[model samples]
Target chain A: MKKYFLPSLKLTLVTIILCSICYPLLIALIAKLAPGRGDGEKVMVNGKVVGYANVGQRFSDDKYFWGRPSAVDYNSAGSGGSNKGPSNADYLKTVADRIDSFLVHNPQVKKEEIPAELVTASGSGLDPHISPKSARVQIKRIAAIRKLNEDQLVTLVQQYTEKPLLGLLGPEKINVLKLNIALDNLK
Target chain B: MNTEMIGIIATFLITLILAFPLGKYIAKVFKGERTVTDFLLPFERLIYRFCGIDPNKEMNWKQHIIALLSINMIWFVYALFVLLFQGNLPLNPDGNPNMTPDLAFNTDISFLVNCNLQHYSGETGATYLSQMIVITFLQFVTAATGIAAVVVLFRAFAGKTTEKLGNFFVYFTQTLTRILIPLAIVIATLLAFNGTPNSFAGKDSLVTVQGDSVQVSRGPAAAMIAIKHLGTNGGGWYGANSCHPLENPNYFTNMLEMFAQVVLPIALVFAMGFFIQRRKLAYVIFGVMTLGMLTFMIPNIISETAGNPAIANMHIADAAAMEGKEVRLGVTASAYWQVVTTIISTGSINSMHDSAMPMSGAMMLLGMMTNCFYGGVGVGILNYFVFLIIAVFISGLMVGRTPEFMGRKIEAREMKIASLIALLHPFIILAGTALSSYILVHFPDAGWAVKPSAWLNNPGSHGFSEMLYEYTSSAANNGSGFEGLSDNNIFWNVSTGFVLILGRYLPIIGPVAIAGLQASKKYIPEAGGTLKTDTATFGIMTYAVIMIVAALAFFPALTLGPLAEFFNLK
Candidate 1:
């Protein structure tokens, strides 16, 4: 066994080390070069940063759009799906409850306008955006609360909406925080 | 009747048929007889010179196993340190204060063992940079170790007694260098190009939605996605798994990722056939594996197309509306990816099995339960070899003649070794599952027991499925979960980790040793009485023995889980 070629062993090991080092360095370089945009300087209200509008948070009010169910009491570290099945009675019940609660809050809104993602939590609870359709459905309630026209609210949702990547990666979505912050800024 | 089921069967059959000719081509390409390795020989030599390692010193099977084991052990220790000291590391997004000792220990073992039962979302929670280091790099090595083992087994099939078994370190290095690294680089680039986030600079900008602000979390996603598929390692960077927009990004990337997951394992059967000089054998094995995948997947897609009665009752558009899945992949593509990844031993999931129809979920569980017949990187080929050996043995018995496999006489010693090799994995998986179930039953309030009774949740059949799924995931080393089970704590982590290691190595060591023993023995010539292993009759027998053994070993547990859940539904 020891009589085999020494050069082969040396070459194999060196190539491996080089390859191993290459991946991390390349990733770092790409990350540095791309430097994907941040949620942008945090928004502040009354001197304290309220929150970035890029992640999901609970909006318990009857008139607000309800996001999906959370697994971790809204604990960011606990972001996860309920891991419940479609046939799960508990899961079904929660969906019904969310829909019912939404209806109660905005009695005039039709069911079809509600986006499934709005009522169903994205697999990760930290889904910062809701489908544009979901945002559109809740426009009337938000407009009623803030004394803005529903059309004006729909226009705002359209402005904040993001298209899927290269026009096909995901559904069009509107960030909840940005929309809510804009609502607050409305005279 | 529905497109989802039609899509699944079509995909499974296509992948199955494709695997064969592909396996044959690969077999020819890698057959040591081919010029690829020879052409790459200079590169291998160049690498050796740079590392200052002697290529002349060839290790036997035992020596190779030792080197592989040593690498694994060292990584385990290294991983432990990373987990222990994670709080001091950087890149912790949620500023997760720190992992508690018990949690850290559980996670440490989980990642190192390659069970990687990730129930926590890393960005939102506190995992030290060190923990991430442990989870990612060690995981790469752990996966590579299995691939290395398969490479060794491939050598055994292709070798004569006089030929070297190949160097463990060399195989290990080549696999990481030639295969994993390049693959990761390309896939990551492609994924990033498709808009899967690959930055650690943080949030990609808060956007407004429906009069509210939301924070869209961002990170170095492309790097992780690359390894996730390459390693058959499936811990999602975030808790949403591949379903997350950032992780999977788009359908084109989604298609690429699914292909990335299966290409290695499919290529490996050809690797085996090429090395063994019997390209036909690889085809047969590939055929059987494809058939097994189709059997489970076709039925699943069909049943799922009928839609859940409960969902249908609720007037939800039950006709293939994959509610829990990303609309980009849809039900068809998601189901296809799910079955392909699970059946091929890649655990990256695009669909939620728990939310998939019960029968679909059962198929996923069964896919894992079969130990990824296309198994792990190297383990899959080794497993097929084991099946091949058994095929020869049983046929030899039927013919009242001694068994001969790949030119080696299979006598009592070889058979005993084969039996031990064959039985150890199932023993660990089924035994551990049984004990866990018993403990759950006896102490219904145990911390691990998420739902003790079978009445609620998915109840009865589905509830049992949750248990079965957990065991299947852990024991098979297929990391996708039943998800519904509350296996988040120490007991499961430690216990499942034990099974994971045993499930991976015992079968590995057993098969390799048998190969070594067989290599040393003399080959018996074929006689009129010689049992023919290549026939379809023997193939059916081989399949029966394997399935029977698996069924008999876990029937009781199956009864308790899926069957029990089935009855409870009634």
Candidate 2:
């Protein structure tokens, strides 16, 4: 037991230095060369930082396209989901409320047309993007409120939609923050 | 057919190709045979001399376990102290406050046992100092502890009528140096290159076009994430885990993280075969594990991609189970990652498990509950060893002979230990779940400051699943959560802490003790009547035992949770 102590201590010290200190420091240095310089990429509008291109933002106004509901209230510092299972009454009520509110705002769209992503709180409270279908669902509401031509807003949504990687990996998603910025930029 | 499918296939093929060489190298290092990394011999010797450890000394199983447990206990105390006082410590750029005592206890035990069941958000809950010292440091050492224990068992298997297994200290250090550290460095460098943050900065504030200010947290995340996956310790640097874009930047990094979590566990299977010179037996074990993994993975992927029927009823277009999943990973990768993480006990999530289709949720739960489908680093193999003993005992009994495994008798004492370890898994999980359920159901208004309603974000069948999943994950030593349970309180922390300790140590102790006892017995030659454990028939029997045990103990609980949820969705 005595013999085991020194070796264990020495090894732990060496490992702490190697794994916890030097290794992270080296990786931090390398991260400097990547996009966003190890900080997330900032979406810029009119020479000001709008938000991270990858992180979702809160947009409650009728004039702007809304992102997914955030469990953390779009607080990137504490990202997470509501973690509510679908069968839970509270979760179902929350979804129903979201659906009711959506129908009231966009009376043209039926209750069934409201995408799940629009009603459900995302796993990462800061989901930067929404499915293209979710983005399209909000087009009528935004165009009605902003007094923009429906075709123009539809084109704008299409312009901002990013395709799945390698044309086969994830779903087509529109970055909510980016799309909202584009919405503001629109004439 | 599609690029996503091609990418998944490519990932599996690459992992298989790499595991064989890695397995061979691991065997050589543990055997002290000459190969690469010999240049570090001086450094190894210096470490031994400085620490006053005699590398030549061989320990019996009892002494090996004593050494392993003592070191772990020291680490646990150290981690608990560091975590409790982290707010006052230096290098805390974020100034994250000290954890409550209950949370500190849970986090420390979780990491020490290689469970990595995080109750607190990483950005706000842990300081940089705590993340580095308590979390990342334990990621390396705890993984090494499991590897070292398994290597000792391998020595026991290889030796003929030997009392000595091997030096635990030597195996522990060598595993860290030769296997874990090098792999972690490579993966860490790659992750950083792919845009994962590795900084000491606090949260960055950004203003949106809508004039809203947001705080984006940054830290030394890449290095921790690399080992978190490679070491099969799935605690994430951020609360979002791999679901966070910076944590898993692209599809490439996502694939890499999945491969990193799986490769070592698979390699360890091959390493066992190489060590015991029982390649056929290793192949049989590997085949069973792969078969189990595929059965779970295929169904999960299909169910997730099929989209939720409930959501489809709402006329949601592009309904490919996109909730709680990143657009970059989509359904296939997310489902694949769920199975990989659960089966291997990596627990890092590319998608939120709570939002998964009900059947997919069941598959993840089953993976952890069974825990032998290529489990965490060294521990997965250890858990499988228990099942092997049960299979041997049952098979021998059926043939009207005393159970003989590798020329050693499976006596009453060995059976008692193995049975205890096997039964303990379901007992802890079920009892804990039952107790939590009773508290939530019978005492909804008990006024414990946290109401039963507050414990679950979603009520009914899914709520029941959240509680069951928590205990199952805890007892399996697989740290993934259903994500909705408010489990940071005293009840959760204390309960899961006990379950984590028992779940981790008992299985470990049972397997090594059995192997040690077997090693010390007289060598008996193989005869015509001896059970051929290496045969395909025995492999099928082992698989049957694993499923039967899991089904008998967990089927009812599963029915209440994921199974009930599945039919409800239908």
Query: In order of the candidates, what TM-score does chain B achieve?
Result: 0.89, 0.99
Q: Number of clashing residue pairs in every model?
A: 56, 3
Candidate 1 per-residue C-alpha lDDT over B85-154 given as tens digits, one digit per residue, 9 for 90 to 100: 6666766654555565555666665565555666455565435254335655655666667776776666
Q: Give candidate 1 misplaced runs (Cα > 4 Å).
A: A1-21, A31-78, A102-120, A126-187, B1-52, B90-94, B124-128, B202-216, B319-323, B444-463, B525-530, B535-537, B566-570
Index of the highest-lDDT prediction: 2
Error of 2 at A9 (Å): 3.1
Query: Fraction of the real A/B interface contacts present in each candidate?
Result: 0.18, 0.56
Interface RMSD, candidate 1?
Answer: 5.9
Superposition error at B149 for model 1 (Å): 1.5
Worst 10 residues of 2 chain B by lDDT: B311-320
Consecutive 10-residue window with the lowest summed lDDT within model 1 chain A: A33-42
Can you write out model 2's per-residue Cα lDDT over B1-570, one digit (the tens) per residue?
Answer: 666676677778889999988998899899889978988888877777776778899999999988888788778878999999999999887778999999999999999999999999998999988999889999999899999999988999897899998899899888877898889888988887777788778898876666677798888888899999988999999999998877886778988998899999999999999988899989999999998899789999899888877656556443557667776666788888999999988888888898888889999999998998989998899899999999999999999888888888899999998899999999999999999999887888777656765898676788888898899899988899998788888889999999999989988988999999999999898899899899889999999999999999989998998888889874
Lowest lDDT 10-residue stretch of candidate 2 chain A: A84-93
